[model samples]
Target: MGAHDAGTAGRGRGKRIVVLDYGSGNLRSAERALAHAGADVTVTADLTAAAGADGLVVPGVGAYAACMAGIEASGAGPVIAERVATGRPVLGICVGMQVLFAHGDEHGVVTKGLGLLPGGVTRLPAERLPHMGWNTVTPPAGSVLFAGLPADSRFYFVHSYGVLDRAALAEAGVRVTTAHHGTDFVAAVERGPLSAAQFHPEKSAETGALLLRNWLATVD
Candidate 1:
């Protein structure tokens, strides 16, 4: 039992999706967006609901260490890892996506992440910090998350750090979508039951809605 729970607890309402509430990220916004995408979304720290949901969404904002602290305190990290290992769908947004990596280097400190993915997160080599606002992504061919969306679809982003080691991710056989800031970095990834977005789809307007809908369609 954690602090919040959004959406209904009713049965057969829609696709059961949990927006993990580990004391970070835009829980309500994500809740509303997922529900709009036809999911019976719940924003909760309840490990049971999180582990057993049809789909699990991990949303994070702020710093990498703080988000990881919240997730660890709420005991959601192992559950997310377990779900991913068992072939259940898990989506990470923004810093949430970054924490899926091996570790993150922020402000001269390296913090351990959930380690579900191959690469680590580091500062974007862009001229500007916090690459905010809408930008188009280069989705890999046959991307499930970007499906039914145009190649030029623009998604919202707000962060200074991202996974820039495309070669490492490629070597791990991960399907990556790259978005260019100062350099090409991972935008989204779809491998097995794990998917992540460095951008905030909930705030990405129509294109974001379509992406959320695409994810919901993959839920069982």
Candidate 2:
């Protein structure tokens, strides 16, 4: 076999995709989930690792401010931004996605996000503190993320703050959302080579696993 054919037979062909460790994320869980999804994931806060990655996943499970602080402090912030700018898929989960936006308004804190997305995040109405529960999404007519979904499969979610009414991102290119807090929050989004979810796919069930699997297929 040729050298190129030999290189094609492995988990992502050792194509390291840095899993940003901002100290505010569930790094191990995300790492395991990605591995299970058939991609070799490397958890790192190191700036150098970012350069080696073919794609990147910035997973987080904390306040946006704290996570941003950790990313900048670790010097992975600018690197991640650079990665995203180069058209590498940057999968951000929950708070991670929030940080990709322009800013976030949570806990009376108005902090700047990575400015990758076009907008900012806002706190949910008083009626719902944390939009916790299982909610299904119906992705728009044509979406790459839900390419093989069963048409009504539900994904797990746990969060309160959201971008806005019905959908969190207008420029996200795709629309997928879940009913929550008497409104709709972006369950997932895909724009060009980038995609993100507002829920923890690692903790989610079969549906989540499938989601990660689909995402890994986009690395090339």
Candidate 3:
């Protein structure tokens, strides 16, 4: 069954969630946000805790290569792959979401990613370097993440690279969300137990909180 198929039944609140501390993400901020969303949150590098939690959050920032290095250094790469392989919930944020794809091309340097999604990260076609500030997104119909969120609600984003093509992801039955920052780019995605957001929901205020709560409801 898809992650949302698990349903919100018996979702008694305080789902145990691990915000992976791989040295690249805003650990404390993510932890606090998840906590405020009613999750029993933990920020740690313990793979055991990560694997065993009801939900695993992989938050990231900065360069793709650096985040990958931290994931490898912390031995989180395999654990994340394993979780997705077994149908456990995994959420990737910002560069965290970017690393789920096959590769990332940053300034002529190509680095490998976790390959959970079928695509590559590239520079946005926008005139601006980083697409910072608030922007609206177009979530697919029946989107669990965007459920209960207003259509015009905006989220915070800060990045230069993004996955531009959604064909492969859509062909694979992944629910794709899009946003524009000089060009249309992937804003979020969901398939089974793996969900990711290119924007920082933690910094997105109420819209983000509702999204986090929606994600938490999917955890078994």
**Best-first order by TM-score:** 3, 1, 2
Tell me which of candidates 2 and 3 scores higher on TM-score. 3
lDDT of 3 by residue, 24-141 (tens): 9989899888887767888999999999998999999999999999999999999999999999999999999999999999999999999999999999999997999999999999
Q: Which 10 successive residues of model 3 have the least lDDT summed?
A: 1-10
Task: Tell me the tens digit of each residue's lDDT in model 2 across 5-80.
Answer: 2333243545567788768888898888777666777997777776557778888876878888887887777877
* Model 3 stretches astray by more than 4 angstroms: 1-12
| All candidates: TM-score | 0.93, 0.87, 0.94
Q: In model 2, where is the ten-residue run with the lowest total lDDT?
A: 2-11
Model 2 residue pairs with clashes: none
RMSD each, Å? 6.0, 4.8, 4.3
C-alpha local distance difference test of each model: 0.88, 0.74, 0.92
Candidate 2 or 3, higher lDDT?
3
